[model samples]
Target: MDPLAALRRPDDPACDVYLTGTVFLDIIFTGLDAAPVRGTESWARGMGSSPGGVANMAAALARLGLRTSLAAAFGDDMYGDYCRDSLERGEGIDLSMSHTVPGWHSPVTVSMAYEGERTMVSHGHVAPPRDPALEGDRECPPRARACVASLVPGEPQEWVATAAGRGSLVFAGVGWDDSGRWDLAALPELGHCEAFLPNAAEAMRYTRTECPLRAARALAERVPLAVVTLGADGAYVADGRTGETARVPAIAVEALDTTGAGDVFTAGFLTGTLAGWPLEDRLAFAGLTAALSVQEFGGSLSAPGWPEVGAWYEGVRQYTLSPEAAAAAGQDPEALRRYAFLDALLPRCGRPGPLRRAVPTIGFRRA
Candidate 1:
């Protein structure tokens, strides 16, 4: 079954996926030798600003040639204008459903990178007032093949159910809960979602288990599909309805920045799911996409395009697979069967075009 077939019908819908969450104007400072001292300020070699949060995933999906729509609150300010223009013009994302509030300020995140790690400071107010167009009886329902959203603790998201009501597959992801409250009260909402993705830490915290695999299994029992991402170690996935499970190792890469890696993985996995690939293949593709993102700086700007995906697939398939090694590689005797789906989807060349200066990023200011 061609999951992407629905996307090709021009009369069907303009967006392949509708994503909703907090959108931040990110100012990423890279190349810091150490954290700033309490008395004195430190210096960074480079800095960049772009849309973050769910925007990261939307950008990733758009970069992969997917028609994506974003629904969120935006302030009528310079930062909001930059984010909206960048996502719409640069990344090809649709924002017609998104709202812009007057007199409200967009969120700003200042991320300092030092030795592959980062310290972020964000400032923002509570959600801005909703647009009158989206109020009462005029609420707009998203039209797409699927919908992606970040889970909010304590209640079922109205958007998730709205999309599902329209026959859109719903994918939900969770964030770090510093409150130490797992808030399993939202588990019932997972029943309305096709998948629930969370990092190992969040999964373990919510499940009260030390093992990520155990957390994944436990989550699967509640949702149709459960995927737990383990940094460096890889990912564990379980399909409750099908009783299928798989664990894929992380693709080795020198990570420059870990920002938005999880978002990129969601984009990649969503792409593979839409293509109707198997569980193992979806996990590997997600891993590869995330590995590529970390090699570059910035959040949404770091997402890999189809070219990167194609190149990685070609490089992996180049390794010679002997009968002995193939047997040890798991079900795929050739060990290359997982990537066969890319044979048709990948373009002839995945090489990127000349870099264009869309944002005036600061680099190497005289100290």
Candidate 2:
């Protein structure tokens, strides 16, 4: 069920969100008791492979019922073929704006997850330059209600500005600055964005503030909305336009792998924002989706769809009804109340069975 179905109009953009970035074939190893020791062979209890990187964000958005359009470069290799098929055919993401470069091979990442943390080793060559004429798309970006931009410090993406100019609400996220200079001024593209989401560390470094909330406030001055994600503590949000601020606690869950959790959080927030949900509700929803993502293996595959969201809502409600159940699970009744907004939203999400997700191997034939 499309969350925006009721809000859709005849003249609205066909795509709900536009994303562009590099996609990597992520091979994840899970259930490891410890990191690998020097010159030792380690056996993992579980493993899975899927499209990662920007594909994580794309899958999250699509699973949440958003009409996601991706503009990316794919290789002609088997790994590339699997990734392209997984996203377009399996996940229902639109790849019309994407292209495959001949002879170029897919980027690959092997991730090891242990103790709620992951270490990744990646290898890939830079993709060839995009030729819009050959790809059969306009030089300008396609119209969409929103777009997610991965902000690289000192390197402004021109497409962000172009999409924003064409009425796309731009939401930006940044990577860690390996240069040791966390200068906010280095990101010129922030001027074109409606919101900026950075993890607590990134936010603190960029604003030179000790507190994440303070950093969010400073960032709000630059963009209309600023969100600082505090991994365990939850998220802090500041709305520059309304002079509003919100802090939502993280949902407690036994995490199996933390990969792609941030992307899932962004997807949930984007959904709530587009639906005109209240500030606190948006934060709570984002935190919940992120919590769910970490419980499963792999990055893009772990993203939950509407069925998962609905099931979680029902489980929480049922558990909270019994004091014994809540106590047994260490569930805080107060934290459960934060997601009460789901009561109104879940009924609207018609019964969709379990969503198909990425598996440990991609060799099995699709039925």
Candidate 3:
């Protein structure tokens, strides 16, 4: 089936995806040879700033040509305006479900990249006021085909339930708990969700499993679909309804920074899943998307468009046909098998034109 066919509905339903969560002004310092030592000043070879968190996923989905809408609170400040404008103008995301707080300060995060990984420090209010409807102030969330959000502690997260009640697929993810508690008690909150996605460590810690596959199965028992991302190992997914499971290996690339790779993976998965792709195809596409993202520096700004994805598919296709090239590519059999599905899909998928350039804006001062 043609992936784009699912999105040709003419009826207005607000958006293809409704993403609500934190949005951070991410100041990324890359090209660092080592992790910053405490109380020491270090120089970065490259620097960039862009929206993070839900914005990362939103921009990715929007770039993939999804009619994405973001619903979250923004501070009454320049940072907030910058984010709002960048997402709308730069990525074509809809902000109708979003709002601005009268005096809140926009959140910010400082990320230092080194050795293909990143360490970040963020400052923001927890549970920043969401759309009033999300807080039970109105009837329902803005209608969409899917709703993406994080799991909230100590609350039922009525928005997920409301969105599901209104016939939207709810894709739920969780954040890391610094307390090292690795609580699985909150897993029940996802009962109303259609899918639960978490990175490998979080999934293992929560499920008390030593492997991602076991953790994915444990999580699959709760939600209709479960996905556990294994960083360099790629991703494992299970469908509870069909009792099927699959693993897609990661694409090989010289990774620069792993900052929002997982979120980008989710966006890619969302694109294929929403478009009715097969399970293995969804995982392969998401894995390829993330592998391409880490080759760049910025967080959401580094997401690949369909054109990039198609180009990569074409490159891989040619590489596999030539014995010497395939040997040099060094892709595992599983990864090659997963990506092989793209060989046929790209021809039918329309190319995405050049991305809109992000408007330069000064970020909030970091201490």
**lDDT winner among the candidates?**
2
On residues 122-157, what C-alpha lDDT tens digit does candidate 2 reach at each position? 999999887746755454478999999999999979
After TM-score superposition, the amount by which residue 113's alpha carbon in candidate 1 deviates from its true location, in angstroms, is: 1.9
Off by over 4 Å in 1: 1-7, 134-139, 315-340, 348-367
Q: Is candidate 1 or candidate 3 better by TM-score?
A: 3
Candidate 2 vs candidate 3: the lDDT winner is 2
Any runs in candidate 3 off by more than 4 Å, and if so which? 10-12, 126-139, 179-181, 332-334, 348-353, 356-367
lDDT of each: 0.79, 0.90, 0.79
- Model 2 clashing residue pairs (backbone): none
Candidate 1: tens digits of C-alpha lDDT, residues 257-335: 7789999999888988877888998998888889999877777988988777777776666443455554454324344
Query: Which candidate do you rate higher for TM-score, 1 or 2?
Result: 2
- What residue runs in model 2 are displaced by over 4 Å at the alpha carbon? 135-139, 351-353
Task: State each model's C-alpha RMSD to the native.
Answer: 4.7, 1.4, 3.9
**TM-score to native of every candidate shown:** 0.86, 0.97, 0.89
Model 2 superposed RMSD (Cα)? 1.4
Model 3 C-alpha lDDT per residue in residues 1-367, reported as the tens digit of each score:
2355646767847578888777888888888999988899999887777888789899888878788888777878888888887798778888877788887899999888888778999998854555445455443477788888787544467678788888788887888866677776755568788888999988898889998899999988888889999877879999999989998777779977777888888888888888888998888888988988887666688888877888887777656567667776685543465577776667766643565422234544569
**Poorest 10 consecutive residues of model 3 by lDDT?**
356-365
